[model samples]
Target: MNTENAKPQQRFLPPPPGAEYPLMGSAVGGGSYNSHLVAGVLFIGLAAIGAIDWWLVAWIDGCLAIGLLLDRRTMNRKIALRAMPGQMLLYSQVALRAAVHMFPYYAFAFVLYLGMAPVVLPLNFAISSFVMLYGFYMLLRVYWLVHYLWVLNFRWEHAGRTFQTHQANLKTRRSAIQHVLWAFFLGNVGLVVRCSSQVITIAGFEYLRQSLNLDLTQHPTLNVHVMSIFWGTVVVWLATFWFMLQPTFLIYYRVHRTFHSCRPLYDSVHSIHHRGVLPTQLDSGTISPLEFALTEYNLPAGMLVPNWYWTLGQIILAFAGHLPSHDTNTWMKTGHHHLLHHRLFNVNFGLIAREDKRYGSFYCEPPQAASAPEPSGEAAPPARRRHAVAALAGEDD
Candidate 1:
């Protein structure tokens, strides 16, 4: 089979017309365009408003709900027009994908409302609105989950043999029980620990304040000024990128070693992610449960700032900036990098290009052209090339 010229299968249709690219350029490279300007402005406006009046969080939630509805309509139209497969199963998958994408925002809004609710009547209206909106979001998520499970069960029953063969070929060795246990433990238990630590820290601080006869209402270190909040959020966002590097390196190295070593347990888990040769937005979450715990679940766990507002800002940044990076082919290198990773497994192993570069493992497919590049007089020393090969070999030992 000649695989070089083979066209990759498409999973989801291209992102709906306007929501294709990240609002801002890639964090690694500063390249911005007009297409995402409206999204950028809207996100900034919402963040600014949120800082001044927490009540506006409800309005922000309303906007997100509207966006989700618009996305659903777009997907429905695609199905109706036969732009993509419109199987009843596909509809359920699309709905589940949307719910999964929107879950973070819904969870963030709920937390924002909990923290920002004021006793005054004017704000009480906002609180009421948030409560109602959150209730709807929860119900919708529940409905989506139920239908998703039913779809899974139906597919399992009807296509059990085929599905099992494909899954086995993918090299995923984890049993259903193991996957569920790891997913629950890492997803739920890790989240519980992270959230509880924050609560416990705050409670401990409050106890100290009361014992020392300090003002209960005053935050000792937090600068609640609007600009401070904005800048602080920015700092936290930047720091999050750096903080995630360690875990990204760990996950990549582990997977790379497992791939090379041909160990059944590790290879099976890692190969699940590699199954998506032509990746879609949905592929981002399509990983072994254990892999999910080690990678995506750990990305946000390193956050040092404990403020709910900071958490909300991170969610907004993720939705507004990072999520779209997965959908479109833009200057944002993430989508391109990930696509390359799927197609050319050994090259571009790190989450960010810099990691690959520092370890001398960076590799990208050369552009197709009629002429080759003119040879440079200077070439990398032999030792450097050897080191690069070793790094690419995942030689932690």
Candidate 2:
């Protein structure tokens, strides 16, 4: 074979027309390009609020609202994936994906309510209790919505850029109808068992409360004083850290490893993610539906905090903590830890650096010298080169 005369093999090719189905995107990827606008507005809003009332939670709320408004403007730009004809189809897929992510939390919440109902009823707290439960559901919905938007936008932008190049090799596999139906059936059965146990637990609690004569009604209103906030903050932070550890380990041990074990599964499902070996923000949830569900199902487990305000605080704080993990910017260290995982699969399996270190999975190449900026009007590299770069940077076994 005359190697010099032969054509070079192409690693990344564009997807066929109308075949693109990306799972999700992230802020670290170009998906949330207008994040700076939102950040700037928030900084100003927070500064102004601090001048008037430094201790008010309303300041945080006000800044968030302004940031959302500013962020919404970015949506006005024509999003390539969103403009595709199969938007509803794509949304349905995303919806099902979201449902799987949330099913566990919803099931657990229902069980918790049933377990607490007896004690709540005797204290004449039924109405307030239901209201609080309903609020928690609504907050969970909002949190999921925020996550959806972040992933959706990133995927849209990513597909616009790379779908054409990877179209030839990018293949998507939908779960069979029978499998989906079976999953639904199993889910209902599990829910029933969970509810039954909860009912039994509630009975036990009711008996105990009655025997002890603990009048929760006397303390109807929760006293969230300064000391309470201090302790609550401490507890929420520790719990959030704990919640992340197990799930992170499970995803690496089970899902990541499983995909690597099956070539066909990896090609059809996992490869959609690894298509971009150098993962961008958009790469966060771009895996197969099963993988997505497995990795994210436990995310909302933190919402199980009994106190409504504390649960909300945990959600916000946890989200803030995760945002840095996905970030690829050089200034952020946490995201690089995860970026390394994407590059080298066997190592850095945990959520934080310490977990990988503790388990002896941590491995990273020393940081390279910064490259010079692309010249003005210069075209981006071809998809093949880009994928090649990513692969060279993080080659896996």
The model with the greatest TM-score is 2
TM-score of each: 0.33, 0.34
Task: Evaluate model 1: give its lDDT.
Answer: 0.34
lDDT by residue (220-320, candidate 1, tens digit) is 55424434544554555555455444643544443443332232322223443443343322233334333333333333322324444434543333223
Q: Which candidate ranks first by lDDT, i.e. highest? A: 2
Off by over 4 Å in 2: 1-248, 251-253, 299-301, 306-331, 344-346, 365-397
The pairs that clash in candidate 1 are: none
lDDT per residue for candidate 2 within 253-371, as digits (tens), equals 43443344333334333443443343432233234333433444443333333444433443343333224322334555566565555544344445566644543445443233111
What alpha-carbon RMSD in Å does predicted model 1 have with respect to the real structure?
20.2
Error of 2 at 344 (Å): 4.1
